[model samples]
Target: MRINVLQHTPNEGPGSIQRWSQEHGHEMYIYHPYQFGNLPTSDQTDMLVILGGPMSPNDDLDWIEQERVLIRQLLADHKPIFGACYGAQQIAKTLGYAIKKAPHKEVGWAPVYLKSDIIPGIPEKLTALHWHEEMFEVPDQADLLFSSDLVKNQGFIMNGNVIGLQFHFEPEADNVREIAINDNQYPLEHNDLHQTGKEIIDHGVPTENKQVMYQLLDFMVKNS
Candidate 1:
C-alpha cells in the first residue's frame, strides 16, 4: 500500500508511523510544502496521514485551506484519513465544526479518555503527546472517539474511514525532544494539565500508545 503524509514543518515529521510503514512493507511518501513548494492530490495515495503543525486551520494561509479542500475531496471519495493535532482541527472544520483556542494550553504528556468503541485495541485512557492550544467541537453525527477534561472533542471518526485525534497517538522519543527544544511552547508552566520536557521524555514514551496507533492504522488500511 502507498501511504502519503502531509507534513507542515521540518521537526514534526512522522516518527513511528514511518517505521510502521517499513515494518508493514508499505511505501510511504511525505509532502513538506515549505521544502517541496507544492501540494499533492490523493489520486495516488491509498491512505492519507495528516500531521500536526503550528498553523491553525483558521490561519490566513493558502495551504491550510487547500489541505481542507483536499480533505473534502478525499471524503467524497470515501478515502481513509488520519488527522492528528492541527490536522484534526482541519478535519472538524471541513465537516462544519468550530475550531477555537482551547481553555488552556496542553503541551506535554497527558491522558485522553476513549469515549467510543468504533475501533478495538484502543484503551479507555492513553497517555499521549500534546502540543496545541486549539481545540475543535465534534462534527455533526460524527463518532466522538476520545475526550479529556480540558476539551470535549479530542477525537472523532466519520464514516469509519476518517479518524482524527487531538493528540499524538504515535509519539517517538526523538520527535518529543525535537518539539520540546524548538516549539518554545514546552518547558510548560506550573499546571496540572501539563508536564515538563524531562517528565515527558524520562518515561521514554509509552510503547503501548504506539502499539495502539499501529493497530488503528492497520485497521484503517484493511477497512478502507
Candidate 2:
C-alpha cells in the first residue's frame, strides 16, 4: 500500500504507525507542511494518515487551510483517511463539526470506554495516551466510536473513508519522551485528567495501546 502521511511537526511523528507501515512493506510518503510548504495531490496517495500537531484547527494559517483542503478532497473521494488529535480536529473541522477547548486538559495515560466496537480486538476499556486540550464533535454522518469522562468525543468513523482519534494510540516510550520534552506547557498535574511523565512511564498500558493501534490500522487498511 502507498500511504501518504501529513506530518505537522517533526516531533509528533507517526511513531508505531511508521513501524507498522514499514514492517508490512507499505510505502510511506511523508509531507512536512510545517517545515516545507505544500502537499502533493491526493491522486498519488492511496491512503492518507494525518499525524497530530500542537496547533488548534481554528488557528488561521495557510498550511492549515491547505491540509484541510487535502483532507476534504480525500474524504470526498471516499478514500481511507486516518487522523490523530489535531489531525482528528482537522477532520471534524473539514466535516463542519465543532472544535473547541475541552473541559479538561488530558495528558498522559488515561482510560477511555469504547462506545462502538467498529474495529475488532479493541477492548471496551482502553488506556490510551492523551496530550491535547481541544475536543471535536462527531460529524453528522460519522459514528461515535469512543469516549471518556473528560472528553465526550474521543473518536469517530465515517463509512470506511474517514477515521478520527482524539488520543494517541501509537506513542511508544521514546515517542512519549519526545512529546513530553517538546511541549513544556502540557500539564503534568496530579488530578483527574492529567499525569506526569514519570507516572505515564510507570504505567505500562502504552504497550497494550500500541497493539490495539496495530489492529485498528490493519482493519482500516483492509476494510477502508
Model 2 segments more than 4 A misplaced? 189-192
Model 2 agreement with the true structure over 1-224: per-residue lDDT tens digits: 88999998877888888899989999999989888986978798788898898788899989999988988788777788889999999999998888998887888778889888677778899888888888998998999988988889999988855789999898887887777777745655434565676666666555578788888788777765
Over 130-224, each residue of candidate 1 has an lDDT whose tens digit, in order, gives: 77888988888788999887777788887888889998976688888787777654446634465776776675788787798888787777777
Work out how many backbone clashes candidate 1 has.
0
- List candidate 1 stretches off by more than 4 Å: 185-192
For all candidates in order, the CA lDDT equals 0.82, 0.83
lDDT of 1 at 8: 81
Model 2 clash tally, residue pairs? 0
State the lDDT at 7 in candidate 1.
91
Q: How much RMSD separates candidate 1 from the native structure? A: 1.7
